[model samples]
Target: MAGEEGKIDPMHQFEIQPIFDGGFEIAGQTINFTNSALWMILTFITLWIFMLGGMKREIIPGRWQVMVESMSNFVTNMLTSNVGEAGRKYVPYVFSLFMFILFANILGMLPIGVIGLHPFTVTSHIAITGILAVLSFSIVLIVGFWKHGLHFFSLFVPHGTPLPMVPFIAVIEFISFMIRPFSLGLRLFVAMTAGHVLLKVLGGFVINSTNAGAGYGALVGIPSFMLMVGISALELLVAVIQAYVFALLTSLYINDAENLH
Candidate 1:
C-alpha cells in the first residue's frame, strides 16, 4: 500500500479508515467499523476455516488435519513446559491466542497488494495488542488472588531475601510487574509495524527504480526486489516467533501465579 501518484506512503497501510458510513455512539465516542476491523474479521474467518480442517478426526489424519494438530501440539507443549501440568487447563486459551496472532501477522504480509488489495496487521496497533496483553495479565491476577489471596502479593518478593533488602526489592519488582502488559504489547506492535514499514519502503524503491529507466531498474530495482523477498521471509519467521513468545510468556506468567514463583 505504497503507491499514491507515483509517490510512496508507507504508513498509509496502517491508517484506520472507516468502511461504514456511520457508527453507533457510546458515551461521547462514535466507534466506526474500519478496514482494520474488517481485516480482523477476515483473519478470524480464515482461522476458523483453518481450524475446521482439523475438526474431522479420521482414523488416519489428512495433511490439513496433521498441520493443525502439529500447531496445537506445539502450543500445548509450550504451555506444559512453561507451566507444568497446571498449564494443561490453559491449553485452549493460549492456543487460540497464539493462532490468532500468527494468522493476523501472516495475513498482513500477504502479497495481495500487487492486486490492489490492502491487508491490515491488527497486532501492528498498540491498542489491540495492549488489550490482549492486559487480558492475559488479568487472568494471572485473577488466578493469583483466587488461589493465594493476600499471599499473591508475595509474587513481588522473592524467596530468601534479607529483611533490609525486601522493601527495596519489592518496590522494584512491583514496578516491573506493572510494566509487563505495556512492554508485552509494545514489543509486538513495534515488531509488526517496523517490519511492514521497512518492506513498504523497499517496495517503493523497487517500483520507482523499475519505472525510471532500464539501467536504473537493473542497478536498483532488482536488488531492492531481492532484498524485499528476503525480508519478507524473515517477517514470516518473526510472525511465528512473536506468537510463540506471547503464548510462552503468558504461560510463564501463569506459572508464577500458580506456583508463586
Candidate 2:
C-alpha cells in the first residue's frame, strides 16, 4: 500500500553515520562520512592539482598554466571592474572562495558512489554553506573596522540624510547588512539542494516506471536520462556562477570598506 503512493524516503539517500568509534568514555563526535565531505575533499584535490599544474614559472605558458592564468585574469577583471584598482589586493581571497564553491558544486553532481560507495551530497548540508557565509561576513566586518575604524559606522548612515531619517535609515541598513551572510549562504545551499532533489525525483520516476513495463518504461527512461544530463550540465554552470557571485559580492563589500562608499 505504501508503495502504491509512489513515496520514497529522500533522506534514505543521505545518511550521516559515524566514521569511527571511540573507547573508554572518549565519546568522540559522530563524524558521518557524508557526500559533503567527499565533495569537499574533491574540491581540495582539484584546487591542489590546478595550483600544482600552474606553479611552474615559464615565459611560454603551458596549457595548464594558461588555464590558470585565464581564470586568474578573469577574477582580476571582475574585481577591477566592480571595485577598481584598489580591489586587486583582495584577489586571492576572492579566487579562493570562487574555486572552493566551484569545485563543491561540480563535485556534488558526480555519482554519489564514485568516492566510497556512500551517498554523498554536498549541497544538502547547510552547516558547510553557513561556514562559508560566516567567513565572508567576518572578513567584511573585521576588515571594515580595521581599515576605517569607527568611521565604518558611517556605512549605516547616508552622508546627507536628515538627523531623524538617519536613525531610521541606519537601523534598516544595519539589519540588511546583518542578514547578508545568511542570505548569501542560504541561496547557494537551497539552489543546489533543490536542483539535486529534482534530479533524484526524476531519476527515481524513470527507474520505477521502467520496472513496471518495458514499452512505457523506455519512453520515460529516454527523456529522464536526457533531463538528468541536461540538469547535470546546468549544475556545472551554476556552480561556477554561484562562486563568481559570492566572490563578486565579497569584493564589493571589501570595496565599500576601502572607499567607505
Which candidate tops TM-score?
1
What shift in Å separates residue 161 of candidate 2 from its native position after superposition? Answer: 3.3
Cα lDDT of model 2 by residue, 64-181, tens digit: 9998888889889988987789888889988888888877777767675446565455655678778888898898889899988999999998778899898899999999989988
**Local lDDT at 258 for model 1:** 88
Q: What's the C-alpha lDDT at position 79 in model 2? A: 84
Where does candidate 2 have its weakest 10-residue lDDT segment?
A: 17-26
Clashes of 1: 0
Instruction: Provide TM-scores for the models.
Output: 0.95, 0.86
On lDDT, the leading prediction is 1
- Candidate 2 — which residues are off by over 4 angstroms? 1-8, 20-35, 112-119
* Native-to-model Cα distance after best TM-score fit, residue 233 in candidate 2, in Å: 1.8
The lDDT values for all models are 0.92, 0.77
